[model samples]
Target: MLSLICFQSLITLSQIWLLAVMSILWIIWKSRNDVKFNNFVISVQRAIGTVMAWIREGGLLIKAPMGNSILDVQILHSLHLKGIPRRSTKVIPVFWHPPIADWIKVNTDGLSKGNPSIAASGGGLRNYRGFVKGFFGLRLSIQTAFFVELKGVILEVSFAWEKGWHSL
Candidate 1:
């Protein structure tokens, strides 16, 4: 199946085909697990429906070319499937307001893989004109979200103090 899709000219079409293949594989694996552990019986039609739905949803996350490619349409047609219509995407414009003169604005964020997993904190210092003054990122050992948040602020504050920017 992969060999057939790999020869496609468009990389985007290849990606869509790959996603469909992965979705089918995932549904099969999940059905096998369900039968093994939960003794759940999934019919053929139900499994196909699940794969179709998964492929449809997963395809949406991937950005295709500007318009539909001929290969894309042909592949779907051959499978007796219809491509999911692209959803209307909404664009929201965001503007950043600079701080007052002689003041430094600090922004920080922390993220962890799991709640108590490996974590990292990062932040940046912006001047009144919104130009970046300094930035820092630290990779910490196992830590919680809350701890990382506070650590980010502490690190940024210490950075600002060291830079002699007291007015934040």
Candidate 2:
């Protein structure tokens, strides 16, 4: 369990770092363009602050998906050379919860051929006790993966409603 948690933490931190790096690079590119074309000169202090702000914003965005702002903040805090500049949050763990009694969960997936050959959509409904309520799989016309996914969801919902499984 500890190893799994550590691995997850590392993955989350790496994702945040990658986002921060991308954001910083974009800011740098924009700053360079302004300096070259518009003759806009940004002070070093301002540049540093801008980078920090972007990093913080990236961390905050990752917080939602990681479901642990404290871990992200701690990683961000360690990135700072001096004292922690920002990003302090109470520890919290957020994990998926099973559907309540009498509720069913619908999981869907879609696939598409890269060569515009065919598309497929599939999904299944599971009750709170992890029993399969229903499932569907179908081949669709050549379409984008997004459309295939949407079709899968629509099929699942329709199936559930038709079967009188409305409390999903």
Candidate 3:
């Protein structure tokens, strides 16, 4: 049955067809796992509902241009899936203040995929006029968010000391 659905998707080449086939397979796998591990059997109707929800959510990620393909529109309409919502165009202005004269400002930041995951640290030194003096970025192994943030500051301080810009 799965092979037949995949074969049909190959023939049609419709985005909806591919989405539906993948969603159906995912629902089946999830249902099987639930029954095997948790002794929970989901109803057929519930499984079908989950597939439909997945299809709708996946449809939003499709990047088809508007009104370009009638077949795409028909498929979406038939599935009762709405197009992606448009984002607001509002913009907010931001201003940055420079450091006092004869002093250097150090800015640092860090990011991690999760609380403790692959992380990166970066920092820059700017003079009173907001001119960049030095900058550094480091890709680190698995680390906590706090550790990465502190690492960025440490790197910035060490870099400034090496450059003889001690008035930070």
Highest-scoring model, TM-score = 3
Off by over 4 Å in 2: 1-97, 115-117
User: Model 1 clash pairs?
Assistant: none
Q: Tell me model 2's lDDT, rounded to 2 decimals.
A: 0.74
Off by over 4 Å in 3: 1-93
Score each candidate by Cα lDDT: 0.79, 0.74, 0.79
Q: Tens digits of per-residue lDDT for model 3 on 54-145?
A: 88787777764333234444656877765442344489998878889989999999999899999999989999998999998999999999
Best of the two (1, 3) by TM-score: 3
Candidate 2: residue 156 Cα off by (Å): 0.2
* Residues 1-168 of candidate 2: C-alpha lDDT, one tens digit per residue: 224343444555676668778877887898899999999988878877887777766655554333244555555567552222334568899864568999989989999866455899999998988888888899899888888889999999999999999988
lDDT of 1 at 151: 99
Query: How large is the C-alpha RMSD of every model relative to the true structure?
Result: 13.1, 13.7, 13.9
| Model 2 worst lDDT run, 10 consecutive residues | 79-88
- Please identify model 1 stretches exceeding 4 Å from their true place: 1-93
